[model samples]
Target: MGPRKITAHGDKGAEVQGKIRRLGSWRRAAAMIVAVGTVWAGTVMPASADTDLPEYLTKMRAPEMWKVADGTGITVAVIDSGVKDLPELEGRVLPGVSFMEPPVSRPEEKYPVHDDFEGHGTSMIAAIVGDGSGGGPHGLAPGAKVMPIRTSIGSPMAFGAIGEAGKGVRYAADNGAKIINLSIGGWWSLDRIGPAIEYAQSKGVLVFVGMGNDGSKMSNPIAALPGAFGVGAVDINGEPLESSSNGSATDFAAFGGKVPIRCKKNTAWCMQDGGTSYATSLASASAALVWSAHPDWTANQVARVLLQTAGGPVDGAKRNDWVGYGIARPSKVLIDRQGDPGAPDTDPLASPTPQPSTPSADPAAAVPPQAESTAAESDRSWKWPALGAAVAVILGLGITGILKRRRR
Candidate 1:
């Protein structure tokens, strides 16, 4: 099997390529992954209707019993296209600033800034913190509020620049946002945004980001933001979304369903896995729920607990390249209530020893960082898209004789 951007060390030293793709407004960017099974794609969207939330949540539950307290009083800042006021999220999302360069008018075309043209930002916010109501997509923490910070230059990201988002994350943290969800990435091989994450961590803020959709089959940046949790997405059947990127950088996994935005009112035509961006939001929202229950935990402590208690436990001792720490289960943190949430000054993910990968070299993802399939509808793009492109040719790390690791 050919390798996509991200590959796992497989049996007999062969790289098992996993398939993946990305669907969006500008161009439908896609990737390839060679795995034991399955294929993937990018970009597909869904509606904010009530019918799809339960099944997704049930899949996330993974037979685990995590009951995180309602995440009230916490604010997760979303830095992407922008969020609109939908019925399901009415009054739940708060208004924030736009780092969208020369900026546009909202409410209508720009100013007041909550228009989700790309649809990537809208899906990410809903996945992380939407309050399940009247048949909606239930959030990882349904009660936590969101802060929208639009930064997309539009559609896909610039190949090697930070765009406008680097500034936005810092602004959100500086202005009192406790959680920042960055569901986007770029391709610049530069160490551009470090201090922002450190600065946010200092404020006791938790940052969640997506590993690039490219790495699900390529050797590139797998969302490795410092002090930020790198998240990967999986499909509804409790399987890894073939396109979900992975690496030592990945902190955890979440249900980023194969979606088709089945509209409830008018405006139909939606389906796609919100990609890795939505996955990161789910990680942020899950952390929000765990933190809301404790209210006294540090960001590190929250992350550590997630790693220790992930559902669908893995096989060996090494951290997974694809599903880092397995699927995150907030229920594990709340139901049994593990972890000490460390002092406000301590970092929970602070390793006693150095990990195998370098921290600052993440290759940056494309704009609207991640994608997801939506609503009650699911897409089989895993098989459809680019069948003719000479995509992946599995490299590095043998796929055979791979060992699994034990988790907390």
Candidate 2:
């Protein structure tokens, strides 16, 4: 298999570039943006090929697990650029909102609600609940419905990126989203979105966030926020990718590197595009599989089961910063009936320390506390190649310079 071509809408290239720049250091920004490009290196397959499935599913034994639960009745909210109306997602996308607009608005009459500005959101949605129609890749939870919440990370029209993200999370939680998947990440502190995250957790909605692709240069604050399930990327060998961020905040790992995905604008399927963003989607879908099977379970119970059944080091002393509890094995949790669901009111990731009786003077002090992970920072070289000079004009020279400097 070889790389396949993926086209983006003409207007979106600038938007993506601008978004990347605002994300932080040019190097980290480029890593996140280019992570999607890796799909071009994957085996190009036709949209009509129905028999094929992504390797990660096969490795996880999704078919064996599907007999018990196919994620029916669960709604996973995808908070990203936007989801595209593709054949794979037909009838599965529920009404969603675009928080980029003030007061938020439904899709206008001119465009579909899921009309993706960049291919990233569509790819994340497909990875969570694509039905595998038209030969597209099947999601881990094909029976799950997705609520697409369109949010712009760096657009001029975007409110503060963090504020919009917080609004999106609150909206999804209020609208019956059982699992919220945030495939976008940055270095911002949790102060901006802490309240929204707390609100979702209070409502018993599970939230999953990407650990970012900055290697060890920086960590995503969203991942560090209490109640957010931070997910990192791993290769087929079950090893964490060098590009995956490491920290106490990352709780799980999933296939994010060299993975196949349905492209945003192009008809062809992409092979190798991925990062922690994709990993977050898979983790969210995995939760859907479990939550759908046991609708009565609270968000904490579901999260506990996942942590209990995750694969990796059995020894309590081993370093797991990069991979966390290891690869997500929803099949193990479902088919093997692993882990106790525990009390509905108790949170698995809750801190044992007592809280202060009084409020702090600093508003930022409201952010919840987090227990740190023991995972060591990665010392490996950046794995992805830089987008060449020809592509720089499209992505911007300043962005390219940042990536080059980071590589050095």
Score every model by TM-score: 0.68, 0.73
Q: What TM-score does candidate 2 get on C-alpha atoms?
A: 0.73
Cα lDDT tens digits for candidate 2, 2-103: 221212112323422333344455454434322221233346756555657767788888888789898899999988767777877888888898765532
Query: Cα deviation in Å at residue 125, candidate 2?
Result: 0.5
Alpha carbon lDDT at 220, candidate 2: 58
Best by lDDT: 2
Pairs in clash, predicted candidate 2: 3-40, 38-272, 38-273, 39-272, 39-273, 42-271, 248-373, 321-375
Worst 10 residues of 1 by lDDT: 359-368
Off by over 4 Å in 1: 1-52, 61-68, 103-111, 132-136, 153-161, 188-191, 215-222, 260-269, 353-408
Error of 2 at 292 (Å): 1.1
